[model samples]
Target: MLDLQWFFLLLVHQLIQFSSFSMGMRYLRRRTKILLMGRFLYLFLLVIMMSFSTSGQSKSAIANFQKAKEAFKQNDTDKGWVHLEKAIKKGGNTYYQPLIFAGDRRFKEGDILQAIEYYDRALQIQELSSIHLKKSIVYKYAGEFDLAIDSYQLYMKNARMSKERFRASELALENLKFTKRKYEEYMALGAPLEVVKLVFSDEKMEYFPSPTGDDRKLLFTARMVQDGAPTDENLFVAERSGAGWESRSKPVLGRVNTRLNEGASSISADGEYMVFTACNRPDGVGSCDLYYSYFDPVKGWGFPELLPGNINTKRWESQPTLGPDGTTLYFVRGSHSQADDLDIMVAYKDDEGIWSRVEKLPSEVNSSGRERSPFIHFDGTTLYFVSERSPSIGGSDFFMARRLSDSTWSEPENLGFPLNSFGDEFSLVVNAAGTHGYLSSNRGKDIVPEQDAMAEMDLYEFALPEKMKPEQRLFKDFVVVHSATRIPLGLANVKLKGLDEKEVYTGTSSKNTGLVRAMHDGSTALRVSAYKKGYLPYSAIVSKVELADNSTLYELPLTPLKSADSFVLRNLLFDTDKSELLAASEQELRLLKKLLLDNPSLNATIIGHTDNQGGRSYNQKLSEDRATAVLQWLIDSGIESGRLKAQGEGMDKPVATNDTEEGRALNRRTEVRLR
Candidate 1:
């Protein structure tokens, strides 16, 4: 119809020019000819003014329209739509191109009815074959289902005579069909489709979500371009408000973000201290070390310091997760022994904020396969972790274990089906309420089809099964340490003995510190042994009497034997001044039996000494005979002969004045050692 209008307007232009020429010749009177010619000129000027006025509006609208397009490209969609609206109001239809784009932007932004009004305005001025197809899109998105079908039918009718037109119309019809299907899907879901706005997005990398107790402050990881070059991922934070997250998503700079990668941060429940992982730092012992930044009320995050040698060794230690109570710390460390992957380990903090010895999680929780990202719930007994070792559908899956009434951990249960898939899930944290949790995954359940592969992770909330939500025992301190060093020990031999030193529950500390956690709600007596090279074994009887809510810090000390420490030989007997083996020394050899049994590592040379009163040669032979007699006694007592060396330091070596009987007694002696 608009084409017919343009054709008629062209004919009117020719008539106007012809009429002016005819009128000018016929009129002889100058005033009359001038008046007739003036009327034709007036008409022509009016037409030119209309044409130029339309073109001016076209230029203005096109300029604003271009700005709107630029705004959309900048991801400022809201501002883009505002400018596009202004372009339409300024009569962009004065130029056909502005009219088409204005309608397109409006339709794509989901303003279907507004788009149809603009498209209708365009069609009224020009009947380009393209306008009919846009009409179909407007009707489809506007939920005018029957109108959409009718518009598409008309498009088919118009296209039947032209193959090119038919193909274009068919494509539009197919798009309308897909839109109708999506519209049904959008309506069927009972809840309103809340738009998942990209609060923070980058083409680089992102992970870790450490939110405070109030959920107002969120700390996460983001890898963004720095200094015109791609850089390692670092911690970035944003705050939440009623209007949604604030912009820029600034990095947590200075100490926390170094030249190396740093992430997996955990804030204390009180929000006072934050522990995170910084790999390959200058002071690190291995590939990664757990460093802590204290949150002072006056100053913010302080300088990060590497944890002490008791925990971090020449091995990788990372993923430090502080329990909500802020005392029990959980982390993952690669196995030092022959193991395939890393395991979850834990450490305990003291009143002075010093960490306990690091120990691995129990075998029930940590298997031979890789287990990482351990998060203890607010309840403390419920430990949630990501594991690829378990029978997951694929990759890694979230599994949880509940504490039992007997204090043992219940068999782990997989968080099944829809919550987990064949992709990797990590950085899991359950809320203080224990009902909701968050994790990161690449699965796209809500994204558009074309961008599904690029779908980024967002926070998800899930419920705990009622059976898995048991009350947990609060741990004030599980202080297990070495007896000698007065230090918290790792990998010590701990057994629950039945009042009589019988073995019961036994395991080593986790990798975080030497403090291994086991359910002790019902145990009677705890027997612990701290073992190390060159130290006497020490055992303690921790009476589980008058049990209190908070446990006490028990320390054990071990004593070691030196080479000068001597033993008595009761079985060695001889005639006056004679050196020979006698049955009497057998009783004294039993004492050596006890020492060997107590200290399995003790190997020594049994040397016999003599007083200065005897001749040197005779004393040497007599001393040798005495040493041989004692060695034979030790052998008879079942001591390994290979462990005993016999040597006589005759009259040459005397300890005291030797003039006194007590000094001579001391001078004639035997010694043993850890050889």
Candidate 2:
């Protein structure tokens, strides 16, 4: 059988060489018949030889082969390989099936060298082109670029390869060469920044580090491996202390974590909401689907629910990342059966909180090659992701795109060498400040001796170079709560209108924590408003001088609506000492009208007050006129006259002492008393 295999290989090689030469038609025809006859005779003898050799082989070798198959089926990978090795030693080398199976198992187990050895032995017995391709892929991942290129070239040279296969091999070879050049360039530049390994990392695979906007808490995925095989992947959370992360981690979202695999999570800016990937669930629409859960202060994590059908299809979907505003979700969607092609897609939540249909990013962001691990910054305009598109350093490199005003994305820019190396770099998350960044990488220098070095995927934090950093903007991260009770006011609408009177941004407070985060372009002259159904509307002008901190925490207080509750209307403005209302006060007036329309039974009195500068009788008439003017405007705008009243207090009821200009400015105000 061994001789027959060798003879067949030699005959095919000679035929390939013969076909390469120019010959007459008559000579070609005669040679083709002779080759066909030779092939037929070879197969006839090969089958007879195999039939006879089955009985001649020792019983122990066959038993070992059978045991190897059973061990592999029973999930005993190490024991299976041991038995296969013994079987190969006992005259099993004549059979290529066992050798190929062992090689495939070793490759999947991260034993690249052992897998290559087995593949080489199988190649000696038969000319299998796929084995060469598999060896090339393993070599490429192992950082053996030169050997990988050589093997790929060998695969391309085989006569039996299809044109499509040849083209793929050529492209892979070109990418490998490009990667080699990038690696050399990186070495020349030296290390760009310091990368600190977190203390939570262990011998098991730990990756996908997602830190809260403040960088005080971290969430990562860890594979639970037993006997050198992964049982499931689950999420672990750790807190930061001083400059170092806590050494220990605990499982979070216990209700969400089932026996099925769950990993690749992205937490909201306030750490209240999470969207992650879960696979093999009985209710999943695909092989993997995205799920969401919210953190409750009392009940802990709420039950996880699969995302809507618009975002998840029969095709695989995973790696969800929520945008800074908490309404946009960026995730990966691809066909699991075709593992090589993935695209970055985004879905946005409408005002009613229903997620829009998923849309794939343009070719500028998602190329024909794979693109994954999208990380939209808290700034909302800058996006960081991984892509294998052209101009990449290697396999999958980090790239970034900025959102333009027209809602289209800018051309992606490759985050240059060192930060993006020959191996895949993904799961990137940047802090709100944009000074530091975290990502998962298996660079050559990051190998730990105690772990399976070939499969070492570790979390790393590095100081972001200025060129690679996202645009730094001030993010007002605040929680809205009731002023009297201090209870969180969830689902409050937050809006930021710029000086141009354009509604620049709008978002809602988180349901779990009442947290609302908005990114500004450092233009502080804007109005920020928070409103909910049952609470009084709140609005404040953020002056230019107030945008200082990278992350400013503000406690937005909203007073609950009740009978006889009165407060100053901060936004309503009138001309100095006149009854005419300013145009800037239009927004506040409309909101008050809406409040009245929303609650038909509610009634309010519009009261006007003044400082002590004016004469008592004149001030009384002026305040009365102003109060009547406001009441008439509301009546003209369709509020029922029976539900409104107008009154004035001329320097009689001053909330602030009229001792100075600031005090006097506060005293000249409009107040609303609900009844």
Candidate 3:
């Protein structure tokens, strides 16, 4: 017969073995029979010992239950739980409070499976069916959808439920059914889906991963814990390396990250600017406000600045994502009174660089339920967000909407199941190429042993489903710089023009990084032009065939427009000996006209050059005719003739040796000199 001490030691050994099984050691399944035998022997010995200790009357089960409550109050959870289990075995169906209390405690502690077992034991002992509803909720969270639905239906049929409980059960049933259907559909489609946990994820909750357009850097939020209690959520960064992501992440934006919570951040496509949400800060205008910070190579991150009143209202505003244009921001705004009714709102920077009044998305995008975590793809047309609106699997599910017009959005479409499970899914961001997507989820195999399996959220990346993906377009990333110093030029105006010379798109390089990006539909040939103050303008043509390169990185060098600064006009063409410009030269002439118009106080001299083949006098006249033709075109195009002059070098000054064909071709050129 086992003594009490031996029984306790055996119980500890059994618990150790069970912990290995809980930790997902499949080989431990063979030890299950051994554990069951040990438990049986423990109960047998306890019964024998109890019989010996009691002479005529046994301890009242209610008394044992009271003792268990006292033990729990004193913080002895193990002893309390063991005593409560004994009371249930002794009292059987005579009492229900002990069983219910144990179940509630387990559920509160996040032991959903153990809570369900306790609830099931209570149901078997008595006809109290109301506990089924509690079991159903626990089952649902544990991903046991089929069992949850059955339990919910049983509770509704066998017990009197409150109106609120009835409504919740109805909603849950509908969601479960929808989730089942979606899972079936996903299986039918056979789409190739893969989800990978980021290497840097840890036991603590890590979520809201925002990667730069290059995918070389990642920023996320981690819930920091101290003394086993959550303290604050702070932004963390991980840089990609050849061996994978860095082994660990560190807090960034020193001054920007205060003791207060700072998370749900969005980095600009160029990785130069960041916008994040902070709550209850001394400078905040609302309960939660969006803040902005910019990166500088020399100074690091600037101090976080509260957004303008137009974007940050006295109400709550958070989760800001900048459009690829870097001027439009989409964020979540909640009413001061009804905090749960979050709506996705957008604001655009005006010509003065001030954000406009926040506008809630249309009803088609924002439903009566909450909508949050708006991520606009780099393509600029597709919008992905999280919503609790019906047709969702259960909780908040991922949905996408496309821009139909400037102010209109298409009906939101569900991202479909597996991508969006019964669990809440949010903070999804797609890469520039739109092929890969990242989000925070708690539905996969656990990587951190200390974390609850599939309960603590971690960042995950998956192949973007084809049905939900946006139209793939070629993107061009531009880095504009000064020619002499190689320093990035701020406020450089960049424009994309179609073959017909219609301006398709326009944006400015970042003030700090001098980077800009533009996307094309892959159908048209495009010409890109960049211009900065007091610098010569630059333009390049990308043919449709070159769009297959996926991305084209261009470093545009702009020379300062100082006195006597000259450059060859590569866009101009003429008949062999005639001075009339070709149609291809029309675009360049228009650009020059704009330049002259923009700088009215400035003047330019148009000079033409010729190769050595022609006679000196004849070549000089030919050059003169070319220069005169260009001046006339500029004048006709609205440039004041007084601001421009014409001259001919006529082989007198050659930039390249004129002996070879290539050098001769270069020598025969038109030049522009600012004076």
Candidate 4:
């Protein structure tokens, strides 16, 4: 006999050759023979058609798989899925490669069922370590802890080549056992899985909606590590609405997001400015430096400038809190003299409008131990911060302190209870409403999947007990600043006035931003006047603030007061006998006319005053006429009547003593108040 293999091949070749020959012979005959041959030829053609069609379908299926791979690699996940579906429909058995890649892309993008479907297809083809790992991650995200653990174990069995991979496998194994135990305990404690979401995921560590108390904006820090390589931590902000946070979380770009690490940002109440820390740079005072920037509603962020030398030094200055008033800056200062210890420092603006050198907060607030993350409440009286120095249930507990009557700080009080655990808590912010806020912690249950053995930091919002509502109150910020010199001014009295010019509140600037934010309740447009001994008082009005107001920055550009200037009283009290002044008084109102003409949009009210000598009714009438005379002069001087108002106080209201003649002369005056 011929060799067995050669004999089998020879048989296959003879079958095909005979089939072809018989097909040719059938086509050649005529009449009955031709008809039979035509039938045979038709059968032969049918076989070829079937074979070619099957081969074309297989090729198309393979092409689709290749296309899916290309699409996935290019990060076009949606298109990749479409191509993958096409490949699956072609009824071919060679689509495992593309399916596996698609599964990975979907898993990374947070898609679960679709990823499992593709992963299942890949497993059907062959057992792959990478595919098992992918399945494990999906299982974790799906909350199937047990299955995810098994998948991870299987992956480890085959992928023990690299030390890093081995370490990762071991860690996963340990975490799986730990998680199983914790799950049992949680169930035993009557806790639900939904509540467990308060924990963080190891894969994504940054917690949003920072505890900063302002709901209009959210501040958070995210470490931008790529492929396990160190990258600068970045600070990001998101605008919050009742509808929820908007898309495109805005990054505090530019100097705030420097090549060096810059994160842990806090925005003042009005959201006009922010301060954050940057570290490991040549410009840094110690290992880190605190820098600040202001946000203009119109022009955007001013360049990041270093804090005054008084606040920054050879020591590390970081974790800055731009107080609600923008006047006081509270921060953690790590002293070079103390080496590793950190103390909280407070700085304020002095009377000359300069920041005082950093002064250590009273011992009640700082200690030899580290105290950081000082958040001044919007009310401008309460301060919340993290301190390891205080007694606590954890490594670091949050504390609150009240600004005492004498301007010293109260003894710090721990925030207490379920809000504190054996784990450390950091990064807290509360909204003006006070019922809700956020804090970062790792003390809760593990959130990482069995496949991820890494520890995670979680963000949680806990409500204070009902009886503690008063203690849980929150504050907002209100900053008053100069239109020029972004620096904050000290000792500048900021008087917050209501629409009626009644004093509502008062405050002074802090060291960080030349601003003073005060506290008030109710709805009213506010007029803020910043006054110095000699400099012209700066006045501005803030109107139409929605409810739950905080730091509202009102910038004032002051004009200096002078001695030589004398203002004319066009609409003075009436002539010698009459209580009314005549229209001819317009001549004396020339200066007033020019002033109103120069500022067409300017609005002012002319108040007429008279000496105490005339009859009460007659003086009232005379003062009224004098005021009307000024108003008429303004209208004639091209000032819009809509922009002018005349009011007569008569002799009833006198600025100086009305008894003495000199005092009477001063009392008989006309004054203009601009709105």
User: Which structure is stronger by lDDT: 3 or 4?
Assistant: 3
Q: Clashing residue pairs in candidate 3, if any?
A: none
For candidate 1, the per-residue lDDT at 410 reads 69
* TM-score for each model: 0.40, 0.67, 0.70, 0.47
Best by lDDT: 3
Among all windows of ten consecutive residues in candidate 4, which has the lowest summed lDDT?
446-455
- Badly placed stretches (over 4 Å) of model 2 are 1-160, 192-197, 278-291, 296-299, 305-317, 334-341, 356-358, 388-395, 416-426, 441-456, 475-479, 485-493, 496-521, 549-553, 564-598, 603-675
How accurate locally is residue 295 in candidate 4, as Cα lDDT from 0 to 100? Answer: 66
Cα lDDT of model 2 by residue, 1-675, tens digit: 667766766776566556546456768887677667767766776676666565455356677878999999899878887888777777455666667777877766678899899899988878777888878877865768799888887877763757896676667678778776766655676655677766777666777778787789888888766887776888888888898888888788458777888889998767777888889898888889899887887776688898764887888888888876556788999997427589999997764467865688877788988888898887777889888787666567888899885258999988766677656675688887898988887663532122343266778778887766777766666678888887888878776666666444566777867886666667547667777877787777766666455355677789887777776666667878788987777766766776788778899999988999879988888778888888988999999999999999978888788999978978887787889
Evaluation by lDDT, superior candidate among 2 and 4? 2
Candidate 1 per-residue lDDT over residues 384-491, each given as its tens digit: 787876455335677788656323566776665444544566657765545445565554342111123223444443454454453432222244454456565544
Cα displacement (angstroms), candidate 4, residue 629, comes to: 32
Candidate 4 matches the true fold with a TM-score of 0.47
Best by TM-score: 3
lDDT at position 328, candidate 4: 70
Q: Report residue 60 deviation for candidate 3 (angstroms).
A: 4.5
Error of 1 at 69 (Å): 32
For model 3, residues 162-193, the per-residue Cα lDDT tens digits are: 99988876876787777767766887887547
Q: After superposition, how far is residue 17 of candidate 1 from its true place, in Å?
A: 97
Q: Would you list the rank order by TM-score, best first?
A: 3, 2, 4, 1
Residue 113 local lDDT, model 2? 94
